[model samples]
Target: MTRMPRRSVALAAAVAVLATACSAGGGAPKPKQIATGYTATPQQTGAPKDGGTITVALTPGLSPNYIYPYPPAAANGTVIGRGQMWRSLYRPSGEGDQVADAELSLAEPPAFSPDRKTVTIKMKDYKWSTGTPVTADDVVFSLALLKAALKESPANWSFYTPGQFPDGVSAEATAPDTLTLKLETAYNPSYLLSMLTLLYVMPSAEWNIAETGGEHLDFKDPKNAKAIYNYLTEQSAEQSTFATNPLWQVVNGPYKLKSFDPTTGSFSLVPNENYSGPGDSRLDQVDFKAFTSAAAVLNQFKAGTLTVGTLDSSYVTQIDELKAKGYSVYGAPAPARFDALTINFANTVDNFDKVIAQPYVRQALQRLIDQNGYIASRGIYNGAGSPNYSTAGSGSPYPPAFGDTPPYPYDPAAAEKLLTGNGWKVVPNGVTTCENPGTGAGQCGAGIEKGQKISFTLASANTPAYVGARDVAFSSAAKKLGIEVKIVTKALNYMYANYGNTFAPATKNEWAMQDFGPLYLAAGYPSSNTVFNADGSFNLGSYRNAEVDKLINESTFGADEKTLSAEVTRLAEDLPVLFFPTPHTLVVVKDTLSGPQSSFNALLSYLYSPEQWYFHS
Candidate 1:
């Protein structure tokens, strides 16, 4: 995965002992601490052995809703689960978080035609568990299905425009094993390949439904499109009994679903004996269990019941105790996401627009945030977190590197100076009122009225301990700077529903700023088209910069690393969001199990090389 400079480590062995002492009434003895850095090399027992069952943990309450993996609402768990049964044309290379490299799975490296407007893919010698040979016709059919589904559910596919095929892209099966894609416009090979990675090849025989009157339905027909899309979508949602679902039984990956419980969001998988992949599944079965909170997950770890799980930064101090119990902790800088404070440019609450409209104010706010302190308090893996300076996170390959110096350092004095210089009167823990309110010199930019106070509510998800704490810390800091910040906590779903992209000025859910997330997985890529562009769907803040939009468009089609880096550098210089420290993903696995633990991509499901995972017996 992408590597960042390590932060200075502080030993907190005493804290671990104290925590254990406070909970000594437990039946099991307190776990002992072991001396080590953030990551310890997983212990190897011998040759890999099969037949043992491994239980994995999932995020609480989040279930796999759409088992047939097309995106608008395919939960992370669904990606991980469906991956076992569905195979894509090309699987992302598991080397790290980079999406540039791809491993040929269902199809070999595509042969591109001159001018790069056309490519041909040849099928690999793979077969479905149902004894049917995987063919190119299946690929063409899947692409058609995706195009049709985009009509009814546009958000399902973000990379392409809805209701229309991708610019100049058309697919057809030339032979049983050969499929060709012709593009009208020239596109970068890497970008095109990345696009292909998103399209999962489905079994056409099972998914393509016949319309009423025994006629084959044309998905492109406006009359038949919605019905066809709904039929396929509804079939995938029937997950009350996974084992009994015939649609799920066919497999191309290493595992197949054995059973699933809709209530607890728990499921089990067994090896796909007919899987034709690089390696075979070593474990006989794998189980996934969901928990509501980190504390609950920790309890499972303490009982030595979890085969594989994650530990957040709050649990970093408890690593030694976990190590003493024969668990191996592996830490990797989070490859695909970054935590950030998003300010809504379109915020309509209490004249919030009047104050935050000024770029100087946004820059000032960024400078006032104690990013490093926040990371130190919330991070679990020592030396793993780094300040994210731009939407293109620190881990991204593209960058005008921000280096060690932040554009806006955490200096409250400097922040106060900027605000006061821009015609705002500093009241110190009181409301900051604008004295001048025009675009002229010494004024608070445009749209500000005299005496307009800098006061707004910051919203965030209430769970995950860190989310609430981060917001509180930010709110407290702002308060000291003569800004009134009302902290409102809400469930994640409610927050997203009201504050997400669907947010509008007239809605009851008006938020001045939102403190949620590492940005979505797609934003992790070097391009800013999806997050920073003027019309970006995920631009929840509605921030629009003509220059940034131009740069994003250029990067989207293709750009050299130098050009891409310059664009990112300028973005950091322009404070679009209050970039926080990038969080590290800590993977804790039983000493007896081993496989690839580092994930450089957005989907955690892609992190596991199931064929290679095995019990070290």
Candidate 2:
């Protein structure tokens, strides 16, 4: 989680929100024409004639698990999904590369210590919709809310808590709009610094009431804790409902929530004419529609009624057809996202614990699959790209890191040898089994109930990535290793819910291997806390690697740059998860849309800069 400076740090965290923008370290290459018979020239600048409304139909499930800075509802920086409704101090440049100048969000530029250990941010002379000036108290309240929620909500903080400043962190307001933060130690500070961009400034007025009476609520206090938690939860669930409270003050962003119709799944935003910013607020209406099915979205696009659709390999062929029909199709290669086959070595599949525990098995699986073949079939590297094991690639997927060679070449011969040397004898029937006659009741080896067969389940998206050609290509390559894999397709939402954690007792016991995406956060590297720790909430396979656990946990409390990168790479090489190629972000937009750069390093968001986009017409 590198902290993005006003102009220094890259937009690493922001890009992570989108599936396709996941990068390694450096930024992705600039967008170039994809030879779809359309030359994309840059749009002219300073052309602001904001009047028309932009209607966008986004994929469902953009809302985060939590919002606000309270127990249960706190520290879930995933709340960043709420950015469509709120604006941060700094924003991504139109190119989607890095943070540019502050619009009306910040009063002045953020002040950093000479060593960059401390950053002082001054609030812009802005008000909430209610007209009260935003203040330092709001910032302090937001931080305190996160700190308190993290301290109280163990369930939510199962992964690392969000908005962690530094070892020794303190905040103070020098003036009404001036707030400063002091850090204990400094490395690249960007991990913590970028968090500020995700911080949704709260109203100090409400916070003062919440924290009253010198009688602060503690997690230890049953009555006080319950009351506080309830209060925060209620507030989070009603953010839009309270948008118009006279006590509520709205910051000067491009748009403000004018109305919300949750039933119809439509929300409207009116421009804040009282404020002055870089881009003119012209759109009179903003409608957000959530589609239940990708087909519905595509049909809407076909009908010329929808503005956007999330294009992946499943639609690449169709998109090409659309291009032939004169529709402008844009595709950006995402940074490597490291889709992996994680082994829950902690849970004994049978008597084969020692065999599966061996790192050789993990390495064997990595070699068995061909990343380049998979990417080509998935249209992952349609433009110019190479296979990468890391989210950022060896460095940045776009510009890419300077002087870093690819790790883990595709090698099947070496893989067989690694397994054979580990004591698993390759039988004539193509089933490799451990050297054992009989176990207690169950059996040993890769197959179910017996060491004779190599069987595993690959749970993936029911949509195109998993059910379509990509899964076929993946399964075909895996089959070459004498491995029998069951491709299980679950709905995308169900996949996130069940695979994010372990399967329950009620579900049929069939899944073993999953070609799933990583549970990455602002911290660019992976952490065992989310999916590896023995007690981790998301440890679906019940993986309990003590050494891996120690390494991952240590990286978070603050590991040096080299240490962090090494730790990330070590876990990667060790094959805690069999890494796979990430998909490219292909978006089709109206020609007038400028500043629509996509990232390969981070998550993607549809509402990243909904306010900044203006029409050429």
Candidate 3:
């Protein structure tokens, strides 16, 4: 949730993200479906205004608590302010085909060596707000600090995989404007670039010192970098100082922090007049207002107090009223985003990890998820969600034929058959038990006791009504097969910061399943590298398979495109997490707001380019 654009922990609940598609309304008014793929390019007759102010709704509960570019998972919020304030080394692209927009990047596309083990990058002529030219030293400092952050804990930076990227690559500024990285292992250009998108540059000369106004030390030294990181993170923890902190004012992006309301987690930004990036800010001020729930957003929208923000689909029936109020609501499936009931493999509660380890048991769980039913039923996603089999999501080219056809469709009978066939005593409306336990056919998987009960907890985020509804549906289905699913409610930010067992060991046995909402990885290349890798920083489930690991490595380090397909396809069947329908992102903008259609890259999710936005008649 820090400076990186890699695996962002996005949720519709507004934790590290804005309000997205969710909620279910009772007794549908007109049975009008929430439209998808309806993004309209902003058009206005009059010339764009010179100066205007707009208030956007930050995802409720996901206000910036930590401002440091890299935050440990416990403190990571959404990328709402970070992207527009402190620029990443490479800007995320709106187009799905490209990993980053070359024009907006601080450096030109990197050139890999003949062996693909080394990379050379040339910097763009850009300056920070302080009038200092951005250079490769800044990028090198960022990477050095990133390595130090990862050193403290892999969870500090969720993108880090043990012995990969920052750990394996040695970087240096060969010249004032050039940086080079020598790699221990060759990498696919696309995969490598995907990792770099998270590399946010800072002012090396200004930030090299560990203390305020101290002598600048060489950040290449691990000791110096770690000390500097510690100091910056400590400063970031003081949320009241966000607007006044001089360390945060030395910006390179389009906006600079103007004010902060610590009580509400709302903040205001002014155009960084010296920003050297692609877009020009026609709006003088951008205010991100935080809310407690989607209903609050709907209230503001109704009161005409909001300019632009996402609206949950539970209010889909009210889109017409908003249209009458001169607002434009667009719904489209977010690119490279996926939602799942992220399982905790390390959660040994009720021998859950051991039972889930069985392929048949995993398949049985998958069969219980009625993705199509959830979307079709008026109470769940209604028509706002799309069926997706792979983490690649809606339009991914990867994955086998299963992309169009689910490998495991919902079937309560099949779920029961699998459990019964696996030597489980299935009792409808009662706890099912393992009648037989052994590493043989017709026996429950190893580690499961002879009389193990099939019951586990499912933690559901208490925001966005659709999430709870889906979990309830799944739980109801599980009950028919005598599998007990205890539903517990938790806040989205609580899940984002404290739920992952890999980083937050204290909470491992607290829950068996979690659905905080969709997590968006890098836009173009959505490879599940650290997400599913055995030792991945974000491997919350702790699910492991040597075969899937080998396939992921081939796709991440190998050059073949089909290798990525093989990786996603294998993951689709393996079910590292229980898949859910990918919901459409619904954004509501005031009619007066005018920008190119591309500016409304709502489907891309999380990265907001307000610099390109303007008000027009």
Best-matching candidate per TM-score = 3
In candidate 2, how many Å is residue 458 off? Answer: 2.9
Query: Which digits, one per residue and each the tens of the lDDT, describe model 2 over residues 188-238?
Result: 443443445556666555444333233444332435444554565655555
Clashing pairs in 1: 97-600, 168-184, 313-379, 313-380, 338-518
Quote the positional error of residue 291 for candidate 3 in Å.
Answer: 0.7
- Per-residue lDDT of 19-51 in model 1, one digit per residue for the tens? 343454545322222113455435444677766
Misplaced by over 4 Å in model 3 are: 1-32, 36-46, 73-80, 602-604
Backbone collisions counted per model = 5, 37, 2
**Alpha-carbon lDDT, every model:** 0.65, 0.48, 0.79
Task: Tell me the TM-score of each prediction against the true structure.
Answer: 0.87, 0.73, 0.93
RMSD (CA, Å), candidate 2 to true, equals 8.9
C-alpha root-mean-square deviation, each candidate: 5.9, 8.9, 4.2
Q: Which candidate would rank higher by lDDT, 2 or 3?
A: 3
On a 0 to 1 TM-score scale, where does candidate 1 land against the true structure? 0.87
Better of 2 and 3 by TM-score: 3
Model 3: lowest-lDDT 10 consecutive positions? 1-10
> What is the Cα-based TM-score of model 3?
0.93
